[model samples]
Target: MKMNNVIFIMGVSGCGKTTIGKLLSEELSLPFFDADDFHSVANIKKMSEGKPLNDTDREGWLKIINKLAIDQSLKKGCVIACSALKEHYRFILSTKLETNAKWVYLSGSFEDVYNQISERKNHFMPSELLQSQFEILEVPANAIEVSITNSPLEIIKIIKKQYMKSEFGLFGLGVMGKSLTRNLANNGFKISMFNRHVAGVSENVAVNFKNEHDELSNTLAFDNIEAFVNSLQTPRKIMLMVNAGKVTDYVIEDLLPYLSEGDTLIDGGNSNYKKTKERSAYLKSKNIYFIGTGVSGGEEGALKGPSIMPGGSKETYESIAPFLNAIAAKDKNNLPCCTYIGPDGSGHFVKMVHNGIEYAEMQLLAEVYVILKELGNIPDEIADILESWKASASSYLLEITIDILRKKEGDDWLVNKIMDKAGNKGTGNWTTIATAELGVSSSLIASALFARYTSFYKEERVQLNKLYDKQTQTPKITVAEVFETYQFARIVNHYQGIKLIAEASKAFEWHINLSEMARIWTNGCIIRSTFMEELVEILKETDNILTNSVIVDQTKSLKPSANKVIAQCALAELPIVCMSESVNFFNGLTTADSSANIIQAQRDYFGSHTYQRLDDESGAFYHTEWINE
Candidate 1:
């Protein structure tokens, strides 16, 4: 449900809640309510006589303020000055109204509060009763606590940052979801978490998440979906980190009843773009915003900071940008690695291509390691070479690759003992499918997929290896050449991925900024590298990257080394799928004339599939009668 734009400035007596609340009401153009105005005559008399009001004496007073806050909020929103000193009292005031009320705690030292109260003239809350108020005060964990050291305007600025308190409601306490909740909470945004309980498996996931992260004071966890939904500030932002397909749909359906107009549902899982598009349309019909967001950086990245791509309405993005930017990873310039990608499924589409490039990069690294090993390089030598590469071509994947090579268990290297079979998570295949549909050549990525599929036939390959008895032949190639070839192939793979994104943007009208996309990928993503930072600067200068002089010069300088490496690998009968495919792709992309004209003629001869002659204008179809001639 949508939260009221009400700001509740709360604290004990003499904390300046009324003064600050009045100014805030003016600043926000909202009506102001003071709890003292609703106090009963006997209650005011009791407080004025240096006696603290008991719970019974305060109950009626709180209820009236709560009603006023709710009523005013429903109309034009409001700011309430109330001394909601206890957690239970604040809960009653907040939940009873069913309004997403933001509580801003005007916290101060006891000495400060007493000094302020002593200076006040004809106030019902006496300085003598301050000690009793302090005794009864239970500081709110969920409220935005602003120190009274600052001026009213400064306090308002701090409160404005926390204006969207209870901003994010995350469903599904899986690894990614839990990490994201902690990340947001750590950034001072309040988040409520929920998870569906299974009989034996995930019954205590939410409970464990709450208990483990109790130190994050602004977080709330609930076993019930309704309570989770009720706790969020409106327009409610609920992110679903469940499984990609039907489970995500089910969660959205379950949340639909408790959700109201303007509430947003975010699918943060690796959902198919088609499904995300459909879901976005479906939610829009009901007047709810739907964001198909892609969150990268795995569990560790999620807990710390991740590269976030959010695709939805621009209006919805602006509303949620504060929380997203606060928790996203920062680049060298300390800019957030989060942006509004485009409308509908663009975020998911970009993330899918990212995963595809990740597959190709990993496969290329593996192939290089194999080549180095066959050339008689030890694990330590391989590690040293890769570590050296980090100085020039730094990347998260390369750094980790060096670490993996250097790791040893007892006397054995860990890489030597690992299984050869690789697993697939479907995103790589999705990338290849999308490329095919777009008629873009992503042979490197496709080959990486095929390599994984081939690796899965381990038992059959093992038997065939015994029958064939292949010999290890050292290739006549230096490590420098191999590195150069790797660098070129890596650049080509990224180019292909970016090309796919560009094509999709044109086809879907996403209008995604390639420069911004590159900038966001400079941190917190698997393929994040020094190259991405350089690419971002280049993209800012010119959109026609292939023809850009700087990029073309780099490609030309690297071509000879890449060609030599590929030729040596082929001569040695070593399978270098990604590298070979990359070279072939580059050759085809830059070629002025290809053998496709002959293939077109054959097609025209076999069937009536038309061909366009070189002399003919483009798009003018012609069929040659070869048999009649």
Candidate 2:
């Protein structure tokens, strides 16, 4: 299984083998070879007859691949392309290699490969024999399987990570790992990783680890857990992101003794909140530093630096923030991808609630999309509508939606081909638990998460089709003009949500920055808005304005249009209705309680302690009508 100095770019002929392999070799600074250029006259003649290649015909080809591997092992790196059609052929060549090497499997489905084959005229292999190639094909569990669907440049970008390193010992190494490592190395962070298996890591990674070079490079290796830990520069800060719960416990139990007192452990996984708190306390009892950071942004976001919500000691979180921020995605103002949410389980708790909001926002967006696509029958210009809406009521989510409409998935559009099914993790469930404990309500986020859960029941939905009509009642509008109104509404909802968070901060005594939080989230995390820069400046000009109504009163001119976003979301068919509902929920606090009248009545009834009111010069509450006169 140790590839001895042989990098094979294996796929059927039409898979950009020659072109991509050449680029890969140049990028990795390796030699290049192609198996297509090695075909014998007899083999070409038999394959031109539409006959399938057998094990006998492949032996010579496999020998050539082995020779190429041995020859390239003497040099630094090499890229060789071959129709490594069978498990046995790959097995023979890997066993015969002189020094360790890698294998990049350029792969696609049979239908896709056959289509490419059919287009070629001068190729020795006929299209009729495509099935036989698939029949012989066996995907090695260890091989780096590069999908053929992406363009050569995208593939090349992924491959560029092959020569980079990840820092601070982190999560999954597939898309997330590669992207994180590449970005961090690009930003100058030395990283070490632990993996259950070693196949995916390359020789460059192994060399980087051994040499202890100062500047970042793709210094990595897949090793046994114990060995991997031993290889690290000590007083280690290991960040684990395997599955949550029991696996976390298992890894912790195993790693406890090996780590010293100054060493730290950060759980970057989505573990339960209570569990994280308990685990942190437990680690502290053992004199170990424990941190729980909540990471969001899917694979792309993770690797590209996600919005990280870290909670632990004031010490440990601060220690890691520099590296974490360096790799995280920027907000609108291009700040780091993270914030210190607070102490104890605050980071995970915020993350759980953040995910809850994510669920609601996504569900709301989906509902609107359905309303537009199914009900409005809007055509190819979905991007334009999304763009117009963003002029005022803008979010990164909406901006991405606009851009997504422009993407093509082969002959069909990506937005068009997507199924109604959505995915949900358990964060919404966690939010429900937390909200119940804290005596608060968040119906919108909860509803959105539940909506995704319901997406799985297509069978039930189909059965329900008999009972109810799918037709939706929709209000028509000139979308371009309505966006101006919607933009105002979005800004209102955003500020309201923010104010609610500020209220929570005050009630719970977290003392979070309303403005800095906005600035920190300007680039990397979800919910980024273009207004964050101005919002931060507003905070700088008048601190605590969100909590101060005198300043809020000063915004009377902006209030009418600002409050209209909620009104619009309600009247219009957009999802901001939930957002609008929150506004009503929050602003409704000033309703007529008449507590002053009641208090005065109580005072008069009890001991004659008076109350002052309109048209009163002195402080007094009238005991009787005659007394008032």
Candidate 3:
């Protein structure tokens, strides 16, 4: 095995990339270059002067680094140190560099790096400037992360071993690798870390000793890929934690050989579910199990209790479910974190779907807030309203969002700091894609998604702003009328969005256990609401069970006020989508659209058959084919 063609010691500045890059290069008898050295004098001057470099400023530096890596690839491997922070930046470097570069992402916490940088002997960069570097650093996903806790030499040896094992290989070492190794060891399952350098596997995880569970601190470390592969227990499972980009792709290639039949590669990142499904299928054909799982609850969530959605072959799930479920988040029922949501990319797929629903639910709430603030001219007291709603609501996420909206940091309300520009992870987009693929019209959900996108175009919205421009529908003289109108709007939005979810489920055959879905959303998931239980009951019975029917029947005799409120709301603002629920209540109750003889005639015309008397046993075809023409 030869050294990697290119090695990058990457992280926020002051993480020892330069020192380690040079040391490793000398050990391998390879030429080493400080990535900082390649930066144009101007860029460094800006950083040293305490200003952040934007995308344009970093381009030339990346080009130079890429050229250096390519130039060194022809000979023995080379090492360079730079803060290759963003996914796009890494893409450019990886694409341009000819060398098969194995990244060494220097890992440390804010305190660890701050203390180190503060104590440095002589550095032009101030500790104050360190935050900017940390802010810019996008930790490389699927790279060989070298946690700085061990002596620099131990880290170096760990990487070197992996490099020597493969002619050229990429090892993914991070969150999962670190603790997974420890667990494997405990289970007598040998494992490998596989960093590019000779160093041990890096625990890229930020251990919170506060939890009193050191499981976060223990992870597998392999000297190298060869060592990692050689030490693999039968049915090896390597879980990845890096970002989901080209680096992840590169690591999959790196681990191809180390995996044998029945080996499982679990992509434990926020990867696109479709790709996961495809990859899982391909790996399975080669007799490897690829589980695309959605891990929620975050770092501590991962260390102790995260809700893990695992999807793959059932056999594979059985093999890993025990361990995964043990670590995943628990619900009120204390069910394990591991849930077999579906098949193929089902776990990740379900997660994406879950997130999409979350996006829609959140956006809907924001719409309510906007209505309250701009439309109703009400003071922003989202927490108060949300708190009251929670008594009747089960949506755990919404409850928190409400609290967040109510929270005030300093004089500023958190909702105020949250730019109206609603953002999204690809899950919302993925949901759109899936819904489209399934031929389901998720109009309400899609509208919610678009609503967030529209919020981002604040400046662009100047020309098309509708809050005041579209209409001047004056409020009624009564304050009671104003409050009543606003409440109606909220109710309408709620019913419409929920109705769409039910309609889409049927159209797509998601076979969603609406009751369970609602139950989960009540706490850990989004869209949990007190009214959701009622909605679940309605949907669980039959498709014809309408929301308005229940409202009208229950409240009509007791509260004429309820009917008057709906009537007043209808006259006030015409939220068209919401009309369907009310329309359903009066659907067959009215004599307008349903007459017995009229219905019979319509049925006969459409079916080309004549309706017989109710007492008759059979009907006759009209035989009006020629007669009608």
Candidate 4:
């Protein structure tokens, strides 16, 4: 590997390029070359006469250096000290090299370089020519930029840390893939990108990404899967950000031939956890590692940083933790909002629940907006109220909601002009199904999903609006009461969602840490909020949060406000389905007694289904022989 690690230390004269190059050559046990030695007699004499060397004079000098770089790179790798000041010069020097020549730019102020030049004991380059070199220098964005502020040893350490033999590979150059690729490159990780081309598209997304980010030295694009796989270092790490299901499976199968044992394949999409589990097991049988990673936050978050949840073998996660954590969102404490969730589908499972809670929260917010608007508050006034709510219940969604409320197109509010229909991409439904499978109550999330479905009946709703003639006054509800109601609903929504997750943890044997999950959701993800931070602390105190005395006390105090808000919305003939269902769920779960006993008797009498009596042993079933009156 060292034989293929060709390095170029580049800067203006007096920036210590030659010194650093020699040191690097010795450190890495490679031969060193100074571009000055490759200069022609005429070029050397011209510099000896204290004259500035122009592009014409430097052309031959660059060719010689290029050949040396190519030749040495093919052999036992070499370090070259070159003042490759211009981008064109660097290009010429690297054009023929099969592998990228790692260019390290030693950056410093003109004053600093001049001072060093003035103090030089003996050199062909004159101090007077230093100014011209500085003037003509074109900084390479593709090169690693190292400041001269640190000692030579420190600078060498920086360069060594920045340069890695093999880079990460990404498949699928879609929006999420492109954004994540850029994010990784920005963090100084070399990334190899490949996209399966489809006809009719004028430009290839992978090609466009390469062209747009040409200045990023660490990013490489490939059209062939074979070459892309081969370009990655041994024990290769590749992430698939393609469509879920069969497409993901197809990509894995295609790449499997090229991948060796211990290499990892990460699925960073919204794949079904069951599919993820199957893939992980399959890959394990082949001696390759599979990670089912859940990446939250959308395109913008991908470009910046997102909360990352990686689930697979603990050893596999450890191998990729450095890259994952380096590119993950940081909280207020500067900790990455990422962690190893568990084995198999735990990461994706957590993400599914995150989306589920996102659905409920959005529905709750929409209900609040509708209630306030029905109460005759203008968009601007509602925006103001939402802005104030930030202090009490701060979240990324809330901030965006406020901005959305304030937006206007000409004389009309954009929200008012938009269609009433809502859309989802299946994660919400997935959560609903998972909860049902676990026999967990997730009425708030289920109600939210149904709300979107009901919204799709646009024609029916319009006709119903025209036919219905019932008139009613808007129920009086204070803004404070409405706010209190929203807060309460949010708690209930999160509570039910968390309960579902807890049940899943037990059923799946994931042993998920609820507090840690809450902490990870406090940033980057769509459902991130100040509320989650508080919830994390609360969960640490007790595992059964629903039955925790502190939460129970809070719920008791907030119940009246929720009831009032629900009553007013109902009186005003507005639907608060999620909130109403959440209240119902809470009531049903907390109630000590109910009418289910009579229903149980009916079932026993009709079908001979056994029912447990209150006075009987808990596990014992009894059949009653009763006569119907």
Among the numbered candidates, top TM-score falls to 1
TM-score of each: 0.76, 0.58, 0.52, 0.75
Worst 10 residues of 4 by lDDT: 94-103
Model 4 lDDT per residue over 492-609, tens place: 8888888888888888889888898888888889999998888888888765676778678877888898888888778888898988887788888878998888899999999999
User: Listing every candidate in turn, what is its Cα RMSD in Å to the true structure after a full C-alpha superposition?
Assistant: 13.8, 22.9, 22.8, 15.5
Residue 342's lDDT within candidate 2 is: 73
Stretches off by above 4 angstroms in model 3 are: 1-213, 221-232, 242-248, 270-273, 297-304, 374-380, 466-523, 527-629
Q: Give a tens-digit lDDT track for model 1, residues 595-621.
A: 899898999999989998778666699
lDDT of the candidates, in the order given: 0.85, 0.63, 0.58, 0.85
- Residue 623, model 3: Cα distance from true site in angstroms: 17
Q: What is the clash count for each candidate, in the order shown?
A: 2, 21, 33, 0
Give the C-alpha miss distance for residue 262 in model 1, angstroms.
Answer: 1.1
Candidate 1 colliding pairs: 2-234, 3-234
Compute the lDDT for candidate 3. 0.58
Considering TM-score, which of the candidate structures 2 and 3 is the better prediction for this target?
2
Candidate 3 lDDT, 304-332, residue by residue in tens? 45556676666676556545644555555
lDDT of 2 by residue, 1-629 (tens): 32324568887667767778899888877788888787777788777887776788878877877777776676564788887766567767765451244557778987777776677776777777777767667764334557788888888776555423232565344445455555665564456665454465433443444355344345555445565565444346678866778988988987886776766788888888778889999999988888888877767677566878888887777656666766677765566768887777767766676666555555555544543553355435666667766665566677777677778878767887877677666777877666666656555554555666677787897787667754344445344424433333333344544544555566666666656655665655565666555566666554444444533553444445435544544455444444454345445433565456776767766777656666777765555332543
Error of 3 at 337 (Å): 4.6
Question: In model 4, what is the error at residue 471, expressed in angstroms?
Answer: 4.9
